[model samples]
Target: MQLQELTGYGAAIVAGLVIGLAGGGGSILTVPIFVYLFRIEPVMATTYSLFVVGTTSLVGSVSHILRREVDFRSTATFAVPSFVSVFIARWFLVPAIPDPLLELDGFVLAKQDAILYFFAFVMLFAARGMIRSSEPKADKSAPAEPPRYGLLALDGLAVGLLTGTSGAGGGFLIVPMLVLLAKLPMHRAVATSMLIIAVNSFVGFLGDLHRNDLNWRFLLEFTLFSTGGILIGIYLAQFVAPMPLKRGFGWFVLVVAGYIIVQEILTSRSML
Candidate 1:
């Protein structure tokens, strides 16, 4: 591969490792890598990231299933509503939100900026989740019975809407919810989160397919590298404890969130 291609592949591997090791920050980094490194347009990069993350998550889910870590019943409960939410958000809601028109002192708020802002906000939220994850949980028992179908459906719908709108896998949000609200163990939560992400990402990707603007070459390379990284990450997970990973992930998300906020501020000022 050429130098740039090698670098891109390396970046993808890093992204996958982060996701496999932790769960959220890795996918978030994909956008910045595409925009800054690969020089892809932000809008297109988001779509591409969706495909890469979705596919990678699917691979991870398979691994989890092989290990018998996945909760299929819970996954189904979450995936179903999430799928519906994705369809509604991608097809209806996003189209309805008018792009910002007037610039504040020439700070033009492009549609892309709006998307980035949303992404940054989500990153902040994810960071908060990572911080909270470091705290000891009082309850560690899986639900005696499967979660009430209605609650799972609601969670899935909310997760799906966010995934469709932001092109995220929703693991950051889902993992915590599964642990805190659904009373699942952390490892099971991670496995179940992967399944939910895989499903939602694929469904959301379908929506993007209608636009027909994906960069297939980049997507394929990203998936290949990320898959390799995930394999390495999984192996590493066997030896390392999760606490270090959680703290490292939290810090990384904080840095990314800061960078995104700065970029938005600069974009706004440039418009002025």
Candidate 2:
């Protein structure tokens, strides 16, 4: 195997490890790894990302499901709309976008660049949430309010759209809405977000399967390495403090997002 391919697989394991240790945000790294290291195109990279993130998240959510931490009602409410939106984004919206989305006198913005630009902004948003102090925890002892199903559905659609378009699990967006709109406790919100991410990502991948010719062997190999890393990370979590790791990871993501923008700009300029 080429060194770059080996490194890509290694990065996949590290991506899974981060998700297992910190619980979310790590899977966003998958798209960049696929695009840069594996030399996959941006659109197909998102497809590969959906499958990897979905499978790993499905594995990660199992513990939370067994512990009875996931709110089934909230999951149903948030996930139904999310599933529909994700499918639509993957099947319709993405394909409908023009190849060269924008062009000026001497410069052009390709569809792949637009997608990566959106993904980078999403990373920036995720990084901000991670670097900041945690949001105030909801009072668990307080009586639960009736969930605003309307708002929950809306947030679900938004998150699904973002996930389908960018291939990042929308946990950063999902957890907060689950807490505020679904009235789930912080732990439950995090747990429930995993389920939502798993479902949405798989749904999005289904669209890709229908539209794209996929490399199943390579995908399975990458996902297997990632799963192994997640298991190792779960074991390591017992001894490590997640908050510090999360903050550091956030800074790393910030740097990566910046790098993507700079790299894209340089590539575009070279094209000119």
Candidate 3:
């Protein structure tokens, strides 16, 4: 294999390990690796990242399901609305946004910037959610009263729009919502989050497919390496407590967010 191919695969493994350990942060790294490390065009990298993240999340979800940790009903509740919103956003809203005309502020937004800004905002939200203390309630049984469907649907719609546009699974967004809003426990929330990510990612992938923007070589390499790393992560989970991992994951995400912000600043400046 070529040196670049090897590097890409190695990066994928690293990304997967992060995802397996922390849940959402690892997948978010895909775009950066593709753009900075692999020298992929920003537009194409976003598309590629979607496929890679979607596939990895699918595998992770299957494993979680096998362990009987996933809550399908809750996952569907979040994913269904998310899927609808993402489809509309990707197909309609995204296109409708006018490109910068010469008359506009010297700062014109590229499609890439729009996507990156969306990603950074989601990451910040996810990081904040991770750091917040969760007051665990003792109720194991399903709530006597169903949650507000309209509110959950709203969460799904917002998450889906970001996920479709940014190529993220919305796991970071969904996990917190499941726990805080749906009142699921942490582990179940994680498992259900994976399922929601998998569904939204697949839906996003379809939109990318229609655009014919996918880069198969990068996708395959990323999938293979990430899968290996995920296995390693799962094994490590057996020995490590999730709380420490969660804390560590939050810091790691913060670092990534900082880097993305700097990159965006540079990109935006260059456009000036």
Give the candidate number with the greatest TM-score.
Answer: 2
**TM-score of each prediction:** 0.89, 0.92, 0.84
Candidate 2: tens digits of C-alpha lDDT, residues 137-194: 6567988678788999999999999999999988767877887898876667777877
Kindly report which residue pairs in candidate 1 clash with one another. 82-156, 106-271, 106-272, 107-272
Query: Model 1 compared with the native: what TM-score?
Result: 0.89
Model 3 stretches astray by more than 4 angstroms = 1-8, 101-105, 133-149, 267-272
Model 3: per-residue Cα lDDT over 142-207, one tens digit each: 655555556777899998888777777766667667877776777778777767877887777777
Q: Kindly indicate the candidate among 1 and 2 with the higher lDDT.
A: 2
Ranking by TM-score: 2, 1, 3
Q: How accurate is candidate 2 locally (lDDT)?
A: 0.87
> TM-score of model 2 relative to the true fold?
0.92
| Per-residue error (Å), model 3, residue 208 | 1.5
Query: By TM-score, is 1 or 3 better?
Result: 1
Whole-model Cα lDDT of every candidate shown, in order = 0.76, 0.87, 0.73
Give the per-residue lDDT digits (tens) of candidate 1, residues 1-272. 67776777788898788677765457877777777678776667777877888888888778889989887878887888899898787777766767773467545677777877888888788777776676346534744554466776787888888888877777877877776566677788887787788788888777778786666776887898987887777677778776678767877888878998897797666756
Clashes of 1: 4
Error of 1 at 106 (Å): 4.5
